[model samples]
Target: MRVLAAMSGGVDSAVAAARMVDAGHDVTGVHLALSSNPKSFRTGARGCCTLEDSRDARRAADVLNIPFYVWDLAERFRADVVDDFVAEYAAGRTPNPCLRCNEKIKFAAVLDRALALGFDAVCTGHYARVVDGPDGRELHRAVDPEKDQSYVLGVLTAAQLAHAMFPLGDTEKTDVRVEAERRGLAVARKPDSHDICFIADGDTAGFLRGQLGEAPGEVVDTSGEVVGSHDGTYGFTIGQRKGLRIGTPAPDGRPRYVLDISPVDRTVTVGAREELAVDELVGVSPRWCGPAPDGVVECAAQFRAHGEAVPARADVSDEILTVRFSVPQEGVAPGQAIVLYDGDRVIGSATIDRTSARAASPA
Candidate 1:
């Protein structure tokens, strides 16, 4: 079968491409140029989609003796992932750009193109397994629990899973690096990139402020009384406790956490740490990997990419999914994903629209 490996200029991707070649699959390597600036090079630990990454990917391809091409998807990336991220924040929600990239850019855009060109599959280095389940193709957690990336891929549909290949799903990250070194790949020791890539300086707040500009607003306590002022609400997320700029301590002497942000009125509400607990979360635009749900089901829910999975009962209706956790959790931000898992298999996921500690479940 012919395969197109999406090389990201990292050790993981390099090893993934090598494994595909070892298996004797007709393979070609393609690096996605996601940055708008043509000459920008990957610098520091947060570099992404820069020219350096593309060059590294090409080097790996050369070592593998495979044809390589760099595809400029910057415009598509900006519209689908980067712009969507900024828009989500502007609407008072915390969004995961990686998830968006996987759903829209990698699986949707790249996969579509690969199929159009008659490639059998789009291979990637994501640390998640694709299994031929009894029902159908299913997504599962990687063997390396610490490196499992299935949470971000919850948005992928059954069709996308059919054409997706993750060669590193069963291997640990350490082993991948070792294999890369053995194969003479220089990316074996490359430092892992950190934080959001587009925010070049790592100042998410400042970056958003530059894009959205300063829309100073009132910072209020739980009682709705103004406690301080903030330059913008886009810089804040649910359960954020630092950089709040609330000078005076609370009467109870407890630190305050951001409980909610109202972009409509440009207000940020902060409260006691306990107020961050959310017991019930409702997700919108549910996407099932295999089969769409018929009714409520018990599953483990992961709210963040690297966060712990909690026990929950989920119900799907129309496009909305309601997940009620057995215990409350902190940092349940709107616009984040609620990926549902049945054991190691990923059943489905949804985009969080609302969460509350006291809200009753409509399911």
Candidate 2:
């Protein structure tokens, strides 16, 4: 089979491309240029879209004796991922840029281009697995729970999964590093990037300020009492506890969390931490990779990456999904992805539209 490996100048992707060569599949390496300026965010421990990273990927491909090329998708990335992120935040929602990159660039644009060029599949270093199921190709969690990325990739369409390969799904990160070391790969000891790839200095508020300009607003409590002032309501997110300039202390001396952000009114509402607990979430633009399930189903719902999935009952109507958790979850934010899972398999995912506190049952 012909495979096009998306190399990100990381140890995992280097090892993935190497393993593909070892498996006797005809492989080609491609590095995506997502950032307009590579040096903009290359300070420390950053990943991908850097000149050094592209060099690392090219070097790895050279060592593996495979064809390599760099594809520039900066314009598309800016339009689809970065702009969308800024827009969501401006609307008082927190967007996950990684999930957007996977859905728009990796799976949609890159995969489509590869398939059009006669490649049978596009491979990546994502720690997720595709398995044969009763209905069709099923997406599952990686063997390495610590590095499972199925939550982000849950938005992929069925057709995308059919032509995608995750070579590092079954292997541990430690082993991947070991293999890269054995191959003398340059990224063997490279530290993993932890911050947003496009945002330098890791200042989300500053980044948003630069993008949306400054809109001074008032910070208030749940009772509409002004507690402090902020440059913009977009700088704050639901459930954020710190950085709030509220001078007064709560009665119990506990910290307050942001319970609501009204972009229309340009006001942020703060409340006690207890108000953060939510039992129901409504998701819009839901996408099912496979067939949509019928009737009510009990499953796990994840509101954010690296969060534990909570048991919930999901109701699907058209493209809208509503999840009622068995237990209330804290910090459910809008614009984040809500991935539904049945055990290890990803059933589907959607963008969170709103969240509400559970209503009381009749006595």
Candidate 3:
């Protein structure tokens, strides 16, 4: 098999490429240059994409004795991931840029290019397993539950899964590091990159402020009573409680949580914590790992990458996936993905467009 390994200059990718070579498959290492400007460096995890990363990738390929190249997809990444992120925040929705990057750039751009160049698959360090099910290819949780990345990978279509390879699926992060060390890869101890790679400063609010600018708005209690004011609504999420400038407590002197945001009115609503409990969600733009299932299916739904999978049933109508949880779920923000699974196999996923919480009973 001919493979193009995506070396992210991390221990995981380094080991993955080595394993592919050990398995006797023809392998080539490719580093994605997602950053437009590689001269200046960002500190912390975001620094993983600096020119240092490219050099590290080249070293890993040299050690593995495989051909190496760097593919520059910076423009596509900016338009697809970063712009979508800012737009989602501006529209009062929380978006996952990693998921978007995989859906658009990794599987779409990189994989397509690999296939065009006569490669059978594009390998990456993502901790998710692709298995052949009764129907076709299926995405499953990695053996290392602590590092499972199936939630973000759920956006992949059946075709994408057909050409994707995750060599680290069966191993833990510690094992990968050890393997890299044994292979004499210097990046064995490199720190993992932080989420939101584009935001070098790690200031999400500050980044949004720069893009959307400050539009002062009023923060209101549940009953439409003005409580405080905020510079912008992009800084706050649906279930956020802290950083709310509102000094006054609720009538019961309990904690208040952000229940809703009206981007039209530029108003944020705060209420008791129970108000954040949601029983059902309406998801849009559902993507199935295989053929879309007909009628309803009972499956485990994951809202966050590391979040617990909850018991839920989904009914698909058109492209919308309506999910009802066995118990009320809290802190489900719009634009976040709700990935459905049957045991370990990824069934499908959809972006949350709306939610309905059951009214909390009296205390």
Candidate 4:
């Protein structure tokens, strides 16, 4: 089958494309140009979209003897991912740009274009699996737990999963590097990209500030006592425990965490660590990989990347999904993804809208 591999000039993707070639599938490598004006990329213990990365991807494609091209999605990326990220922050909510990129750019836009051009599927180096289940194609976490990326991909819809391919799902990262080395690929030793790719310095706060400008606000405690002042409420996120200039010390001298960010009042509220625990979350814009389940369904819900999945029940109502955790979860933040799973298979996901206060008594 003809497949278009989304190469990001990284070792994982290079090896993924090579593996597809080895499997006797017709493969084409395409690097997504997320930024129009190239600058010095920051790796920050992770990989970056640098000129070197594009060269590395081309080299790998050449070694595999496959056609390679760079598709410029800079404008779309800025609008769909970067701008959305800034806007979410300005609204006092933390947004995941990677998830947005996967949902809007990779799956929606790129997949549509590929299908129109007669490609059977669009492949990527994402560390997630897609398997035929009882109902239909189901997504699962990668074999390698540390590198599993299902969280970022939970936003994919059923139609998107139909033509998506993840060649590195069952393979380990070490083995991928080995394959790249054996294939004489130059990116075998290339490091993985960490944090947001467009944010060169990993300064999310600074990036948000630059986009939204300074909106000075007051930092208050749970009791509405103004403890300090901040440049903007966008600079803070739920469960953030550091960089808060609130001069007051906790009773035990432990740091306080941001419990809530009120964009309407331009205020950030801090509380003790205990206040971060949440037992229920309400999500908006739910997307299912397959058919939406009926009534309250038991599933594993993941709130953050690399975080553990907690047992939960989801009540889907059109565009809104409400998830109640079996156990109170700490750091449940609004605007983060709440991905649902049935064992290893991904059921669906939603963007967290708000987290309800813990129940007075366990039901």
- lDDT of each prediction vs. the true structure? 0.90, 0.89, 0.90, 0.87
Write down the lDDT that model 3 would get.
Answer: 0.90
List where candidate 2 sits over 4 angstroms from the true fold.
361-363
Residue 63 of model 4 has an lDDT of: 88
**Ranked candidates, highest lDDT first:** 3, 1, 2, 4
Which residue pairs come into collision in candidate 1? none
Residue-wise lDDT of candidate 2 within 224-341, one digit each (tens)? 8888889899889889999998887776788989999988889999998778888888999887767887868899998878999989999998778999988888889999999999
TM-score computed on alpha carbons, candidate 2: 0.97
lDDT of 3 by residue, 235-266 (tens): 89988989999967788998889999877798
Q: In model 3, which runs have C-alpha deviations exceeding 4 angstroms?
A: 39-47, 358-363
Clash numbers, per candidate: 0, 0, 0, 2
lDDT tens digits, residue span 1-363, model 1: 899999988999899999999999999999998887644565543756667888899999999999999888999999999899999999999999999999999999999999999999999989999999888789999999999999999999999999899999999999999999999998999877668877666888988998999999999997888889999999899989999999768999989999999999999999987778888989998999999877899999999998989999999988889999998888899999999999999999889999877755222
All-Cα superposition RMSD per candidate: 2.1, 1.7, 1.5, 1.7
Give the winner by TM-score: 2 or 4. Answer: 2
Let me know the TM-score candidate 4 reaches against the reference structure. Answer: 0.96
